[model samples]
Target: MKRMSLASLAVAGGILAAQAAAETAAADDIFACYKTAPAAEPDWTAIARDYGHKRLKQGCGQQWPVAATPHPQRASAAAAALAVKTTPRPAPVSDFIWFVRKDFADVDMFGKPQSNEKATGAELSWARNNTAADTIWQVNGLVGLAYSYLNEDYSRFIGASLASYVKVDKEAHSAAASDDSRDAITVGGSAEVGFINPIGGADYVRGSWLETRDGILNRTTGQAKLEWMPMYLRVNRQIPGTFVTTNFRPDLKVQYDERQGGVVPIGFSGFGRSLRIGPEATFLFRVADFGTTLPAWAEPLAGLSGAVTYHWWREVYSGQSGSWLDSTIKYDINPNVALAFSYQKGRNEETAKRTDLYKLSLNFKTCAAFAGFSGGRCTADKD
Candidate 1:
C-alpha cells in the first residue's frame, strides 16, 4: 500500500497557506482604513483622499498612488476566503466491533478406535478510541456452543474471548505492503490484552474442582494474554526490478490464569506463564487506484496481524478434555461488516471418552444506530 506521508504532507502544506493568507488580509485591512475617512466629514474628505493616496501607494508598493477604498479589492479578498474553505478538514474516526463464527474437525488419539465430531462457536467484541478522548479502540469476543454426535449421544461445549487496544500517541499511523514488490518487508508492533475460556477439557474434571489426590485432574478458569504480533509495517523499498513487498514481525506473549468451577477435583491450583519469539506472515495486496479487484466471491478485507496458534488442556475427569489447532481467515463482507472464518481441528472426550472433532462456520454483521450518530446505510451487496 502507498504510504500515508504523501497525504499528510498535502494537508500540512494547506495549513501553512491558510496562515499566510490570514496575515496578508490583516495588512490589507490596516492600509485601507488609514486611507479612508467618513464621507460626512467634508473638511477631512480632501485630506482623507490625499492620505488614502499615500497609504495606497505604500500598500501597493508603487510610486504613483490613488486613494485607497475602505474595503480591499473584492476579488483578492474573496480568493483568500476561498483558500481557507478549500483547506482540508480532519476526518472523524471511531471504534468498532469485530465478530466471528468458528467450526472445526479432528481426530482423537486416546480412543481405541478414533472417532470424529463437529463443533461450532461465535466471537463478539467492541473497540474504542484509547487516546485522551477517543482515538483508538479494538475488540475480540466469542460465545458459541459445539455439539458432537458420537456413541449415539449428544455432547456440547462453549467458548468465549475478549481483547482491547489503546492509542499511545497523538499522531500514529499504519501502512501496508505493496503487491508489486517482493523481498522487501515492513516491521511494526502493537500490544494487546486478551482472554479465553473453555480450557480444552471435557471429562477430566468430575465437576469443576481440581483435586491433587485424584492425580492431576482437569479444571476450567480464566486465561489472560499480553501479546505482540507481526503487522504490515513497511512497503515499496527495493533495489530495482523485483516482486518483493513483505511485512515481517516477531512476537512476545505473557499469560496468567485463575481456575475455578467445572468437574475438576479440589486442591487444583492455576499457574500463569509467558512466551516469546517467532515471525509470521500477513495478507498484502498491491493497492489499486480504486482499492482492489478481488475474486467475485472474495470481498476486500482488513487484516491486523498474522500468527498461528495451538491450544491444549486436559482434566482428570471422565470425557472432559480437548485440544485444538486453528487457522484463521478474515475478509470484509462490505465496508461496515466483516466476516472471519477459522479452520479448526481438535479432539474432545465429552461423552464416549476421546473423540475426533471438526467444525466450519461463517459470520455476518450489519450497522446499528447509536447516540448522536447516523448509522451506516445499507447498500447493494459488494461481496
Candidate 2:
C-alpha cells in the first residue's frame, strides 16, 4: 500500500510542473509581440491573426498594461493649436488726412484798415503716409497752400509748399514724475513757391521792400528751408481738488532759410544765407472735465483751454545779426475755434524791418472739430 501511494504522488507532481512551464512560455510570446509592434496605433488583432498565436489573441482581447490611453483633454488641446496655426490675421489701416485752417483778423470791415498787416488768411494742407522704409525712423509727406489777403505794403501773397519730415528718435520717459516725457528729435525740409502782387503797381512801392520780397516785375519767388528740433520736453500736473490739468512744453528749433538770391555778405551788395535759432515755451491750463459736475450753463466751457507761448529767436545772415521776441496768448472756446492775442516785436520776415504789432484774430480748424472731414485719424502734426 505504501509503494502504490508514492507512485501516484510522483505522477501528480510531474503534471503540475508541466502546467507551470506552459504558462511561462505564453508570457514570453506576448512580450515578444509587444516589442515588434509599430509606434503608431497598432492593430493588435491583425498581428495576432498573422502570427497564428492563441496566447497573443487572448492578450489582444484584454487591456494593454504597458501602454496608456490618451486623455480627452490633451487631444482636444492639440486640435485647437492646429487651428490657430492655420488662421490668418487682418491687415493694418492706411492713413489719409486733410486739414484746413482760417484766421480772421479783428478789423473794421466797413472801412479801410489803418495798416495792411492786419489781414485775413487761410491755410490748407494734405498729408499722406509715406512708404519709405521705416525700419528705424518714421517718415511723412505734406503739401500745403496758403493765401494772405494783405500785408503792410498792401500786397497779396499766394504760396504753395511741399515738405518731408523724419522722426529719427522715439520719445523716452523716466520713472520720476519731473522727467516724464521727452519728445523725439525731428528733421524736416521744405520748398515753397510764392507769387506776390502789389495793389498799387508802382516801382517806389516795390523799391522800399526787403531783398526777400518779390517786386511787381519779379512776381515769382522761391524759398527752401531746413528745420531741426533737438530738444523738446513736456510736463503735466493735475490740480488738487478740481478737474483742471496744467501742461508745459519747452522746445528749441534751429532753422535755415535760403531764398532765390545767392549768398552775399552784410556789408556786401548782393544776397546771403539766412538762419534762425529759436526757443519756444508753452504753458496751458484747462478744465478737463467741465461737464461732469458743472451746470448746463457751463457746457460751453467743457473743452475750454488757454495757452501762453513765448518765442525768442536770433537771426544770423550775411554777417549781420538781429533778434526777435514774440508772445501770444490763445483761448480755445472748443476744439475747433479759438481767439488769440499776440504782441510781436521783431524784425519782420516779410518786410525785413523792425516793427511792433498787437494783433487779435479768430482761428478755425477742421480736423479737431469735424474729424470725419479728414477721412482718417486727426493728429496734431502729420506723421
Using lDDT, give the best candidate's number: 2
Candidate 1 residue-wise lDDT at 265: 26
Off-target runs (Cα >4 Å) in candidate 2 are 1-93, 102-232, 261-271, 290-300, 316-327, 330-336, 348-353, 368-374, 379-383
lDDT by residue for model 2 (84-190), tens: 22335333332233333221111111011101111111211122223531112211111222111222221232223332322221222222332212222223333
Q: How accurate locally is residue 167 in candidate 1, as Cα lDDT from 0 to 100? A: 11
List per-prediction Cα lDDT, in the order shown. 0.26, 0.34
Candidate 1 lDDT (Cα, 0 to 1): 0.26
| TM-score, one value per model | 0.31, 0.39
- Show pairs that collide, candidate 2: 264-271, 264-272
Candidate 2 weakest ten by summed lDDT? 200-209
Looking at model 1, report the run of 10 residues with the lowest lDDT sum: 108-117
Q: What TM-score quantifies how close candidate 2 is to the native fold? A: 0.39
